[model samples]
Target: MNKKRLSEVIPLWKADKRNYVKKSTFSTYVLLVENHLLPYFGENYDVQEMDVQNFVLEKLENGLSQKTVKDILIVLKMILKFGAKNKWITYESFDIQYPTSRKSHQIEVLSRTHQKKVMSYIQEHFTFRNLGVYICLCSGMRIGEICALTWEDIDTDNGIINIRKTIQRIYVIEDGERKTELLIDTPKTKNSIREIPMSRDLLRMLKPFKKIVNPAFYVLTNDSKPTEPRTYRSYYKNLMRFLEIPDIKFHGLRHSFATRCIESKCDYKTVSVLLGHSNISTTLNLYVHPNLEQKKKAIDQMFKALK
Candidate 1:
């Protein structure tokens, strides 16, 4: 792409500070240059105002979402600023704004009866993966954190479990079906790296499970390697189907946990901590929170006392 007409300074400048960036950031920068920037303006291309306008229009029409277009434009602006500073090109003000973002979607929470029925189904039928489902129901652990759980993190004597990491997998569409790739990652947020106290029942259930051999991780295969996220998801889905449960995203269990917490008068701060939320605001804003029934009950109690 060093073939276009305007200036050769960009590649040189990019190569110069390659050492300053961290590996992941540098990799992303390389990808941006190779995959996005270069194709539009090979080396030696002059970017006139009209050319910039035309490119912006093309970007919008190309099915890039507004957020993505905004990001691309930000990258462009940085490159142009770099070019101007190094004396490669003259500058004009470029306005970069985005179309409004999509509104937040509503969260779905299972009603108490459905939650009880699902638990009963799992308990009576599927014994092995029940811990996986139960933790999501009780603590709202992300599937990744649930999958990453290890025997070492379980403090059976103290009735607490340390959440240290998570397993994440991304699926890229290769042919028609998606191909999966796995990566072990830090908990989604720093707050997610936390400790959850086990209920007495949970502690009792896990006692015999602790005798299982684990060379390193808590949840492992026969060979002691980690459980793959996709595999866990498949197992979870199949278990739900076998139980004859209505199909809800596995994440709904987390919502049910949080909702039940509120209904039980578990304080928001405690619920926030239990859920490993980075901030209480995230817990309040995202969780399908208290509804009118809870509020009406409190008002009714106050009036009954007045009589």
Candidate 2:
């Protein structure tokens, strides 16, 4: 087989890859490769399963989440597959195992009281920027999606928020120099391009703006220029601090919305669709947890049915 270092093959793979994926997705792949994979295995001419297993363990030790580690591995495999296709290296399949932890991972969400307090605060003192947060809480839209939204996408007459696009700043590496660019693209998956019915309050809040605001301008900025996720996240953090609410990551807003839906006994499939999840299982895994009371009630109902 032809022997070549992985570093040598990466450029060729990336050149071929750039044509096939979205710019933001390609940037993500490049970042994962540069930050995680290249440093570990760039100079090596061959990669073995054991090497990958060791790398996984090291990444885990470095506090990378299991999902992030797996994402890095996926990029690794793609580059290797491309190299193999070009006859530059022999690619072998890796079956890596992760250490199972006894600790249960809990999803972060704002408590119901805090959620209501934040929503109430936004409604009482409404700015266009703050309205974005209110929209996310009511419709379960992601930060990127909400940032990319425009007045045109909000149909107050129908009370529907069209979730068609997302915006983020992506890091791009070219000629060994790294730069970031704001990218506005369609949602990552087809499922994410959806329609969410607005709550009555959300519809009322947006109706006045819909008549006066520029249809092409971004919702958050109320201008032709869109605010990037990083900037919006910073604003969210400061807002939480000012309101004396315990800070959670920005994604906690979406989680909080989904958790509220589940708590309301909304159907799992409906919640999944509203959240734009690819499948219902993802929604269930993240939000469906039966408390002791619910478990006891379920058991009682089963015995009653038998009797």
Candidate 3:
């Protein structure tokens, strides 16, 4: 039997896998292999469970999130399985355990006053570009989805915004060359392709211009050329600073929208569908956190029922 290095088998596996997955997915696998797997295990054809377990610990120590490390391991396992199937190496199944995480990520949201302030300010002083931020606040559109939207996707008559595509800049490495390119593709999942009703305020703001702007022009730029996510994010940062609002990620707008919906007692399934999450559990887990008031109310209701 011919001995095969892990490095030698990776390219072959990538070539096979490339045809079967989305470009974004393939790019992620390649990135994980080059940055994580190759550096750690490329020279070793005799990969073992202990080596992988140690790699997981090392990655955790290096400050990579558990999810990210698991993603890397998934790619590594795929390559190993491919090599094993072809008789290039032996494959061993392994389980990776993470220490109990003490700190949970807090979902950042705008205070109701802050949210109202932003909406009022934008309405009083509006720009075509500034409207994107308002849309995100009113509807839970993601940065990429909002950036990709063209005027044609907006239906003034029905007051709906069709979320059909998303724009992102993806890292590509080919023939030993690295480059980043803009990719306009369908949203992250089939669930993400959805329609959101425009608020009355949004419709009023957008209606007049909708008659004048070319349908093919992007909503963000009102031109054929669309602003990318990075540029839009910078614009959002400026808006936040100008409004004297505390610093939060652009994604926080989406979180604020979803949190507001859950607070208003919108059904979880409807919130999930509106947010384009693939499942209701994700919406519940992220935004349905109960306050002390709600917990106490629940306890009171239980006592009343018992009586």
Candidate 4:
């Protein structure tokens, strides 16, 4: 039996894995290995379960979230399996445990009054850049999706916006110097490629400009050049500050849209589809949070049913 060090086998495994996954995914795996896994396990070909458990604990203690640690572990497992398949190493699966009680964090969303105030402000004092935020509030589009949208993606006749691509600046290491590149690609998931119908108000606001704007120009920039997510996020932050609105992450616009739909008694399946969530459970877990009134209503219904 031949044994190879993890450091020696990982490069070969990465070369083989590169052809199978998306460039972004491949980059993520490379990053995880280089940043987390290889540094710890590079010398060991036959990694022990206890070693991995300790790694997880140490990472958590260092302030890495459970999801981030899990992602690192996924890349680690993949490399281990690759080495095993080629007889460079042997494999053993390990079960990991985490704290049963997790800190519950509520999703932040704008209040209805604040939402209305922002919408009204945008309607009265509108710009092509501000329109992206308006659309996110109404349609639940992500920052990347809004940044990538072209005028052609909006069909006024159909009143739907086709979500096809997303723009992100990705990290890369070139010649041992780190640089970033702008990548315009399909969205993060297949489900993210979807069409959302525009609200009547949104459609009305967009109609006059659509006639004069170039079809290929990005919506946010209203020019051939595109605005990236980081820039747009800063723009939103400044806008909120200028308006004296409470600060929230750019993603909260998406959360606000989904929460409004759920609050209005929109069905779970439709809300899930509109938000481009991969599955209904994600929609339920995030947006189906029952308020006090809802819990009280449920109890009242149960008592009435007994009568």
lDDT of 4 at 134: 96
Q: Candidates' TM-scores?
A: 0.67, 0.96, 0.97, 0.97
lDDT of 3 by residue, 6-100 (tens): 99999899989999988888888898888999999999977888898899999999999999998998898899999999989888898777888
Residues 153-222 of candidate 1 have per-residue lDDT tens digits of 7888888888888877654333335455566667876788999888776778777777775636445342
Stretches of candidate 4 off by over 4 Å are: none
Comparing 1 with 3 on lDDT, the higher-scoring candidate is: 3
Model 2 pairs whose backbones collide: none
User: Which residue runs of candidate 3 sit more than 4 Å off their true CA positions?
Assistant: none
Better of 1 and 4 by lDDT: 4
Candidate 2 regions exceeding 4 Å error are none
| lDDT by residue (tens digit), candidate 4, 1-307 | 7899999998899889989987778778878888898889999979899999999999999998899999998988999999999999988998998765467878989999999999999999989888899999999999999999999999998999999999998877655577788999999899999999999999998888889999999999999999999999999999999999999999999999999999899999999999999999999999888889989999999999999
Alpha-carbon local distance difference test for all models? 0.70, 0.93, 0.93, 0.92
Mind giving the per-residue lDDT tens digits that candidate 2 earns over 108-213?
9999899989999999998999999999999889989998998899998899999999998989898889998888899979999999999988888888889998
Error of 2 at 256 (Å): 1.2
- Which candidate model has the greater TM-score, 1 or 3? 3
